[model samples]
Target: MTHQVHLGIALERAGWHPAAWREPSAHARALTSPAYWRDLLRTADDAGLALATIEDALSLPDRFEPVDALRPGRVRGRLDAVLIASYAAPLTRRIGLIPTVTTTHTEPFHVATGIQTLDFASRGRAGVRLVAGASAAERANFGRRDIGVDVFPASGRVEDSPEILAAFREAGEFADVLARLWDSWQDDAIIRDLESGRFLDADRVHRIEFEGEFFSITGASIVPRSPQGRPLLTVLAHQTVPFRLAAEHADLVYVTPHDDADVVAIRDDLDAAADDLRRDREPLRVFADLLVLVEDTAVAARDASQRLDEWAGEPLTSDARVVVGTPADVVDAVRELAASGVDGVRLRPARQPADVVAIAEKVAPILRSAGVLREDADGASLRTRLGLTRPESRYVGEKVAL
Candidate 1:
């Protein structure tokens, strides 16, 4: 049987299109408010989507030129992604809350503890989308050395400067240490024996003595083992270095493939990387990311996207595939990609609430009828719902075969 097509929504404030904030349906000013996020997440929960990815950056959205900062109808600013996910966790029951955290400037120790807390808050439904790269402006905010985005090429081929490679290398190490820290506390470490007056087993908790080019850590995380041994680690990979990093660390990886041919090629690259991985783990779940504009019909959706671009005063662009169609058309496009071995697609709704609602009501049914989607809220953890097993801690030794 074909694998089920998993679904996730990329919850960008004001939606994917820049002009979406100007749309009547968009509450532009409420993008940072907790109430706004609760409502949006509730929509996903009510619709039974598999996951929701909240986007973030160290810097505000702006143009290269300073004057363009004041451009009207262009959305700008966002709340902290991790905080947003934490705020939404209680309001929604099942959708996985994966928030983007930049590995470039943030410390690994902080990232480890933060996501672990999010997992506890969400009861194992938390995932982290590790991002790399900090613009000069963003670096200025943190008083750190600037890491230029130019090192990452548009063609997905790696011809990077030492600085660029170092940035990705650091990101890879950050991901590695995060996993170790999460598993530093063995699942059986916490023992509440009132008579003995001992709460934890010292031997069960081990130090993660990790040393890398950019980071060095000896950690036994303060938090206990999260519900998912390791909250799902994921990365968005476009080039060789990032692909290798994703293959080495991520449980699920997101990619931007324009068509079936693109999907096949990228999947081949990722498969090769995974096959050569130093560690033994399950094959990576590769999800293609897309910007979707689903309206009453395909033509209307295209027209709407065109209008959004016109309003923004330039052609709207994105790293992911952009699909303009009705819910049925969107399903067809997803099916086409799935036939070429794509595990699933994470959609960035061109307009939020409405487009996402349409996906739940229309596209989900089509997928469910075809056995491409699981029935609503059927799993205990995000890992289970995605058909991933709860991984044993890396510190634990493998069982000896009989």
Candidate 2:
């Protein structure tokens, strides 16, 4: 197939594996250090990976569990994902830095400006993974909304839960507000004409008076028009509600497909959602999420995975499929995914630094050689590299109309 895969890595504190921090190569102690993040991102940047997504959440890791029932040995705590991405901006170039921004608790205005600032900091290589905060524990931190007693009722599918559906709906509106805010200032709004003694053209800025079910955001973004105009927006979707949200607002959507059938089914669902919504933008770019552990040999990789699972006192389980194998094995899996019509794969390294290093040094080369991975487009913005156009502001002529 001629379709080139967009490879991305998901960065967690130590790694996705609960016992990853126990690994010798894991930078457990340096989890909060900038140097650690710098090294990890530099590795991906040098390897020609398309993007790196920094995961975030309001509550501590494993907050879903009761305090007494919380697992003890797992890696806990995290620096702000946006700050981490911003810190890595000057440290590397090329790879897109997408930080998770929980929409449930954050103000849309803050979200827009913060990401716009990141776009400026990264020179256009910035994106955000918009996620909704679901945990009651997480909600307690903000105390802004009451999502009812049963966050995920035991009776129905978690995604079908009323509170969960409401959260996704709110998140969709949140995304809409962000888009409006990002476009409030026209690209040429800043004239910088010193002779005229004017910094900006008043007619070029428009106020977005948006009032939604969850949020009401007013006016232009505090930040200027960013390098990519509106930076890339992404969402991770596992169910119909979220798929609809992604279809409506995301430039890219990360999905978990356990098999070839799943890949096709999920793609169909996303397409159906976009069609149903009458989405006029480009079709959402689909990236399958995978928890990966790679080694020189298949046996060795499985052994490592088993060892990590043993350390954690349970086998590794994830919403995404877990792949434990050699580089060649990974290439084969990716080949299958590509044939199944996935635009890309975002691998969550089972062990930080170690698994990520292996992915960059080993798996990436084979994918490139096999023509599954795309060649690097040097000095391209994240949107350009992902083949997405830098969009024009939706409110371009609004001031004139008024």
lDDT of each: 0.82, 0.86
What stretches of model 1 exceed 4 Å from their correct place? 1-3, 62-72, 146-156, 375-379, 397-402
Q: Candidate 2, residues 271-296: lDDT per residue as tens digits?
A: 89999883578878899898899899
Q: Candidate 1 — number of clashing residue pairs?
A: 0
| Per-candidate total of colliding backbone pairs | 0, 0
Could you tell me the TM-score of candidate 1?
Answer: 0.93
TM-score of each: 0.93, 0.96
Cα displacement (angstroms), candidate 1, residue 140, comes to 0.7
What C-alpha lDDT does candidate 2 achieve relative to the native structure?
A: 0.86
* Candidate 1 lDDT trough over 10 residues, lowest sum: 61-70
lDDT of 1: 0.82
* Candidate 2 pairs with clashing backbones: none
